[model samples]
Target: MNRPTVVRTRDELRNVLAPARRAGRTIGLVPTMGALHDGHLSLLRAARQRCDVVVMSLFVNPMQFGPQEDFASYPRDEERDVALAGQVGVDVVYAPDAAHVYPPDFATFVEVGGGLTDVLCGDPGRRGPSHFRGVTTVVAKLFNAVEPDVAFFGQKDAQQAIVIQRMVRDLEFNIEIVVLPTVREPDGLAMSSRNAYLSPDDRVRARALNQALTKVLEVAKAGETSTERALAEARAVLAEAGIEPEYLEARDAENLTPVTRFGPRPVLVAVAARVGRARLIDNVVVDATPANEPMAASVDTTGGAPCVGRC
Candidate 1:
């Protein structure tokens, strides 16, 4: 296995990637906070297939987390992350420190415009607005620093993917954004770093997110086009599971605007809920045309059918 060369500073990162760019080789970047998991590796594998160099960034941006959120206890294992990155053929691990990323003099932040972040990113008003702002800012900075030919994001973060895609188009970034399917656990729980916080009971209840989303797919497949009915049924599925759903609504897959009725364009059925201490989000894009069957629901890039290995 080719071990990845880890760099913690922006200067070191540029020094490392400079030659690859000068050599006229394509670069692929997978931006992530540390604590590597199967979902994170899937992104790297996709990047590996397309680019000569695959760079995995492991920085836990303080800005993305709320004051009461898990920034301090959000799980950090740098040594293990590097080992896992190597196993997946990652060429570079760009792990920058908080101070290094945001110097004492740093003041500017990137805010995605056009009210794109009004809904998701942990319920705007309840938490500070900085979550999405921080995500966009850090992404902008990473784009500037790494200068990747292509960048990858998971479909699990459906809204974030949409937000970033808009930012790229609005700001005119040259990098291509690719959103892959969401990877899930054997029992159908969407894989997430925060899954570590779920208690055994919560872990079991957390499967409801995927279960509810699955029902939406089943509803669409059954030719149930009532957006109101499908969404209500999904919420009832969660209610039956005894999970507290935050938001389960139908929206245009691309813009995330509320959709009263399904049509030719794809409808993104997204849901966020709190099963335990962990707040989980999962979504599936269903073709509302009634003729076309439901497409790939979540990001399942295991390179096989769901439950083939994990189950």
Candidate 2:
């Protein structure tokens, strides 16, 4: 397998991509914080299929981690990550160091407001808006550095994807945001780099997060429209596993508004729980239309539109 050329600074990355741009080849970026897994590979595969050139950003962004969070202990295996990216046909791996990404003079941040940052993972009592602020800042920097035509993200980070799309739209970044389905384990657990923190027992218990969302999916497919009813099913599932979710709620899939009942708009059933040392999150989007099919967990939008309808 051909190994991806690794570049650690903005200038090197730009120089590496310059040829592709001059050749009129579409470039795709899969931004990551290292710890390559099937979830990350899924994004890479999608990028390889969609664009002529693929660039993966392998920075473990400290800005996105809270002081008390696992920033210090987060997994980092650059060698393994690069090998995997190579297997997936990634053309370049832009793994910048902290100092390179955030120098002494770094002061700006990108915050996506309008109520998107105050809920779910961004709940004031949780990671809050600061987490997203870090995310947006790094992503904006990546967009500027790579200048790719399209960016690929996984739906497992549904809230993050939504927030990034909003930022792209508000900032008028000329790039397409293509979100793919959440890749899950055989037990239905959503893939996350944080899964590495889970003890064996916690790993088993973590399935409750997905089980709860699956319950919501079941009820929604059965014509259950009441958000409370759907959430109740999810709660029962979590309770059976002796897991108390930090948050288990349903919302408007598009705007993240609180959804009282599932009507014309699709409903996003999201859940977050801390098992052992890992804090895990999972979600499923249910189409409320008569068809009652499960909607794609993400939206694909271009030209700064938050999304193209249910894209």
52-121: candidate 2 lDDT, tens digit per residue:
9999998888888888888888888999999999999999999988999899999898889988888998
Summarize candidate 1's per-residue lDDT along 1-311 as a digit string, tens digits: 78899998989999999998999999998998877678888888889999999998988888787777778998889999899989989999998889998999998987875655776553565453567788889999999999999998888887788888999998999999988788878888888888888999899889888888888888777788888998888888899889877778888888777787767789888888877888778888887555664564333436211110110
lDDT of each: 0.80, 0.82
Candidate 2's error at 181, in angstroms?
Answer: 0.5
Q: In terms of lDDT, which candidate is strongest?
A: 2
Give candidate 1's error at residue 64 in angstroms: 0.8
RMSD of 2: 4.5
Off by over 4 Å in 1: 289-292, 296-311
Per-candidate alpha-carbon RMSD to the true structure: 3.8, 4.5
TM-score of each: 0.93, 0.93
